[model samples]
Target: MDTTPIAAGTGHAEAAAGGGVRVGALVPLSRPGWVEAGRQLLAGLELGVGDVNRGGGISGRPLELVVRDTAADPAKAAAAVEELAGTGVAAVVGEYHSVVARAAAAQADALGVPFLCSSAVLDALTDEPTEWVARIAPAQSRGWRIFADFLLGAGHRRIAVAAEPSVYWAAGARILREHLAPRGGTLVELDARALGPAALCDELVAQRATALLLLVGTPEPAVPIVTSVRHDPRLADVLIGAPAGQPEFAEWASLLGGDGAAIPFLRYLPEHLSPLGARVEAALRERLDEAASFVAFEGYDTIAVLAEALRAHHGTRTKAADFWPHVTAEGTRGTISFSRQPALTAWQWTWPPIQVADRDPANPTRFRVLHTG
Candidate 1:
């Protein structure tokens, strides 16, 4: 229970004295970005550790978490990984930002430590040939493809993509275009960064687009865009899709108020909840005192996967390459397998489950799962 802040340069002699397996958790705890998300991930990490410790703790030895604050910066994230390596953590987990996770993965590879990326969806994160890096979340391209399929299956021919100028959004927009074009569908690309929300909505309506995809980076732009489109009577039939960015958060529905109703978004886990998922959600809700998000579930699952691998190896520090086979075979969310295709790297979770969900008008806290793939 004693979580004394360990300085970056400190030795791990004290932490290892009790024969516990130290696991490093790298998250953006400081400000300037993603503070809430980092906290939620940490909460899940702690809960998973608690559950592991309760159930005889990894070959009867306790699991200790060494926390490091990445502050959402790539350089800091890389440094955190190096520091965690020096501190002698058996493995590392928990990074929400894609850029930060990419940098940290490189550091972990160099250090020869296993890194379980919790929520970063960048395709290139797993594209590099590194045995040290593994991802529990699906790649962004896969999520975009899921969204594209959902839109097209609903008989939508004309699709419009409104995206901000960022690597994540750009990648998503590109995937949408490629998938839709081949299926005899047309895509209208709009730069939400260049145009205000009202202007973007006006342009989308003018295009007579049957489906509008918002790939904006944050909720700031998405809120107004969804609100504008939902309120307009002219765009009543248009399906407004907020893929990957804002709608994933639990706060999105409350922020958008009634306008958030019936707007579909890409979700890794279903809101209706599986039995195991319900138990995890209940624990998180008790700890956080509010509804838990998908990121929290991801954080818990990352640790669960790592613990499963560790237990299989009898608490020994397994090599990154050796560890993933066990993970792919025994992962909690079905089988956490990977593909070695050239487009994807060795550690990418190839068979990740995805769903298109929209908020319930009567209960903003719950999402109605429209389609699962």
Candidate 2:
């Protein structure tokens, strides 16, 4: 499979002719479902490349991005990995969907190429025993805990969890149940795929649920759920939330229109930006002509971490195992240090900062920071 090269106005031909270090980006740029997300992720990665190139790059060699459109498909993602492996990129990064990340991880392992997952949150993406895969995003378990804590702190005792049957959503739901049941809080579980949005709203109201924790994995299902709940007068006051899911993206708000107001979701970055975060945000705003989302932050940080690792190894250690230590060290977003005692994953970013933000009705494009947990 052939992949496109986004040179960021740099010398694509010169870079490909042994003038730069190549890094592969696997994002769903062509698929109708994930096009916007792919675009934002690509923008963040390009910004990272631009910054590195401006700083004389790794060991004075420029960083070139070889872009591949995963199209949100697992098979296509794996194929892209195989193609990138053959192309001799120093590392690979960028995937929004968990399933695609899993596929890309497996292919990266088979091909012995290092893969830094930017935004995929499924635990299994790193759970499998693979030396080639590392993730910059916190796993679903950590995200669920943050969401549950936020709900409990907000006095949301009676909560409803609306989740689809996907592995990612199911894991989040299980974590929520385990965390909330012991705190003297009640949880009402609803199958999003089994029930219509209106029926789900009715169920939430009947159960006297004060908050609806939506674990729907994507924006398509979330739109209907958010709209149905908002339109129902009985459920108007119900606090709707998700565990680092659809609500973090601007497209989710756009799809729900005015109904997207006050929907909360967990984010890895804090409400108040760090000095580095503020700089990155400014760069993103200037380049993309829009506010950066959490996904973009993850994208930028992932590439930044990879660039740091490449520089630390002096561009000689390109193998996954060779760069694992440097990649897990401190980074721009936060310390990406991994722990094996708590989990088996080789490089899982433990204890990443998480915050809950809600979309503003007045400005659906911008989210209002609610609480940083």
Candidate 3:
């Protein structure tokens, strides 16, 4: 637990001999809406750091985390990163929303520190040239592709896409439509709303389409929409699915009862949550005491990958500029590689356990992968 700095890129033997280094964790903690998500992230990171330290710390130095709250606002997120700039953190991990991650990316780049985005879904994080920012979760673009492929294959020829105009939702819908075009399916609705649940529900119901691709972040926002979708006999045949952006589908299914059908894809159903998920399910559960929400595990895995990067180099010597190419690690989701096109790593990972659920009396609703094709 000594604060001695290990030589940058030193081996664990030497670094461990020296003790541990300090890391920074930036989460959105300033608001009630973002507090639990931030807490979940902190919980995962704590579990990860504890494991590393218990195993003799990273590069002989234990990993220390300095946490800050961004309040889920982009400007606040940037300010938080600015505060951590000169704090001498080996790396930065956090910012759950894509909006906040985008802000941290700008600051982390200027400071030349490795930034790990735990839950942000927008591909914008990896789309442009970024030296230090690497995302541990599947980009929203990939989520669109995976879900589109699953639906097209599952014989769903029609899809109704819906979301607010926010970057996260819009980006997801855009990518899904693009991926769906070649598959012989079509996005029948792209209802862009600027309102809350009830208003959004009215818009969604007006789509007049059957299969639904909900792009909202949480189930609460979609509860009214789901209620309308299931209760209205006009849309009775619709198959419901959502990206990992939202909370568990159980809320809607429980309300709709036997009216609901399976949800083929729910983004990141990490091993922690799904008994049939990624390879690291057991180990992750043992460490974090629960299966990670798609975003939480992404955050946990982000920390895990960065820890390896630090261990690989022996200590915190490599800055983001030099560390970009060296960031190669695997997690419960997939390989954490990077692509330099946007100046980020080539890592693009996904949660393959397509979470499918239904409300049949014979088969209670829950997530499971489906063969869309």
Q: For this target, which candidate reaches the highest TM-score against the unseen true structure?
A: 2
- Which is better, 2 or 3, measured by lDDT? 2
Instruction: State each model's CA lDDT, in order.
Output: 0.78, 0.78, 0.62
Error of 3 at 247 (Å): 4.1
Q: Mind giving the per-residue lDDT tens digits that candidate 3 earns over 1-373?
A: 2323323334556545665586778776656335656656766666566656666667567776667777778887787677776867778887777878887887887777778777776777744576677766656665567667767767877677666667777667778778888878778655535554455445556765557777664444555666666666666677777665343434445555554445445556533433323434455456556554454566667767778888887757475666756667665555656654332332334333333322344564444444321
Candidate numbers, best lDDT first, in rank order: 2, 1, 3
CA lDDT of 116 in candidate 2? 86
TM-score of each: 0.88, 0.91, 0.78
Number of the top candidate by lDDT?
2
Residue 360 lDDT (model 1) = 85
Which stretches in model 3 have alpha-carbon errors above 4 Å?
1-20, 29-36, 190-207, 247-261, 269-291, 340-366, 371-373
| Per-residue C-alpha lDDT of model 2 across residues 146-183, encoded as one tens digit per residue | 78888899999999988777666677778888999899
Off by over 4 Å in 2: 316-319, 327-332, 335-341, 361-366
- Model 2 — which ten-residue stretch has the worst lDDT? 337-346
For TM-score, candidate 1 versus 3, the one ahead is 1
